[model samples]
Target: MQMLMYQECIDACFDCMVACNSCYDACLKEDDVKMMADCIRTDRECADICALAIKAMQSNSPFAKQICALCAEICEACGEECQKHSHHDHCRRCAEACFRCAEVCRRMAA
Candidate 1:
């Protein structure tokens, strides 16, 4: 429940959220938006979950660990999806953030 105890996880969540948002915006601007539908959707979902995980941790919610577990799963999925399009700088950055966030969240959940 101590905020300081989860600072790393919180930071990772925030970073992942930002990266996902950026990826989402970039994907929308891609020439073939239709082909990026899955990536866009996953980015949005990943961003939302990261935001929720941050909130849960900051608020000292009893379910913070569970939320982190779910966050890790979503982060991994998002990382995989973004990695598919790693040729794009935005996607590459997002994939990295998602993977980092997943590792941090997994530690928090443990």
Candidate 2:
């Protein structure tokens, strides 16, 4: 029963990780990659944190809630950064994914 609840959060985290990776790659391909430095860095951190959050939840770690809390923070920050470059479809998608992940993480953490 509890596993089912965490499953949803795990799925969201996985999806967000994928979206962040894609967005980071797309940003690097842009004509002005340097302009997306912050986005790139944040996206990478968000993706890594999402993966860690998923793992922590899956293992039922004692610190799972803490990991989810940190994940939510990074996800929100990444979402904001991506939203700033919403002109890019990849960035928009990443932002949406990050927002979704953050919501799920927060719910699970609480």
The TM-score of candidate 2 is 0.97
How far residue 39's Cα lies from its native spot in candidate 2, in Å, is 0.5
Q: Clashes in model 1: which pairs? A: none
Off by over 4 Å in 2: none
Residue 34 in candidate 2 has what lDDT?
93
- Tens-digit per-residue lDDT, 1-110, candidate 1: 49999999999999999999999999999999998899999999999999999999999999999999999999999999999999999999999999999999999999
lDDT per model vs. reference: 0.97, 0.96
Candidate achieving the largest lDDT: 1
Q: Please state every model's RMSD to the true fold in angstroms.
A: 0.8, 0.8
Per-residue CA lDDT of model 2 for 1-110, tens digit only, reads 66787999999999999999999999999999999999999999999999999889888899999999999999999999999999999999999999999999999889
78 in model 1: Cα distance from truth in Å?
0.3
